[model samples]
Target: MKRSLQITLLVVVAALGLAAGLAWQAWRDQPATVPDATGTPGSDARSTITSLVVGKRRPDYQLPDLEGQARSAAAYDGKVVMVNFWATWCPPCVREMPALEELYETYRDRGLVVVGIALDNGEAVVDFVDPMGIEYPILIGEDDGIDISRDYGNRLGVLPYTVIIGRDGIIRHAHPGEIDLEQARAYVEPLL
Candidate 1:
């Protein structure tokens, strides 16, 4: 029957799509490296990397928080700052938020500032953040988000990019991809 054949073809197509997605996931998960400004490949995902700006001071940025008030990076000067570039649509970015939130809550008293720069729009951002209990400042950056991310070594323009700056203002790490709490602590604790 033509109808049966059509259904079978649909199922086959779906399976192929899923296979491709899984393959991509596997590739991203591997210990991937993006080269530093000098073109030397890093040993792993979390490295002082791609931009010459890494190992330099954190860049100045002003963007509106969820409530529409302008926030300047200078406000958190002299603190250990983690700037995470994320979007609600990106699955890894969404998944990594809770850990970042936890890290913020734990170390804020010790002068740690976790800033989430969101690239996508809508009430869904507020909705997604509140119920999940994210208290760290979320800056909406739908307009200039990608450019800002690229400044700190997001050569691939990937979601869930993170840059950790020391209290002295030097960029300590620029990591592209998901980071676990353990990895976060390792990167942050010494600086704090």
Candidate 2:
């Protein structure tokens, strides 16, 4: 009986050891997860940024605003333009709206045009934009905005993606996440 008990204990220990080994192996095989401001799990920091390379001509596309007025990259050509792709639902996106507004207010008259593309449905974007008093042209694309963003180099569909286009019509920088006032100054001051 004692021999049988010893053999059962050995089997249990082996099974536990095998399970641990498998778990470790699985963990090792998984890509590293970086914490974002949204606290989403399994979010890859690298994949969040698309089209990191600068000096490429930005793809041109036309989208309508909440008022149904057409806006396009070409319309703002020969000006230092900052095209920001954002969604109303994204916390980080909402957080940076004021900073963007400030940036636009400060430089709009100086040949800097800041365009906000809102990726939201129906009147949701209008409702959000109205109270915020966003001065720059805001184009509404809804879900189709995802494809537009991908075309602009936001392959991961990340919110709060910004691309700076020099007056020469070349992309100077494409970045993901919220832009602080200082970063905004740095990006636009040189182009201005």
Candidate 2 regions exceeding 4 Å error are 1-53
lDDT of each: 0.81, 0.81
How far residue 10's Cα lies from its native spot in candidate 2, in Å, is: 33
Give lDDT tens digits, candidate 2, residues 69-161.
Answer: 887789999999998888888888888888888999999889999899888875999888999888988998877778878877776566788
lDDT of 2: 0.81
* Best-performing candidate as measured by TM-score: 2
lDDT of 1: 0.81
Per-prediction TM-score to the true structure, in the order listed = 0.74, 0.75
RMSD of 1: 9.9
**CA RMSD, predictions in order:** 9.9, 7.0
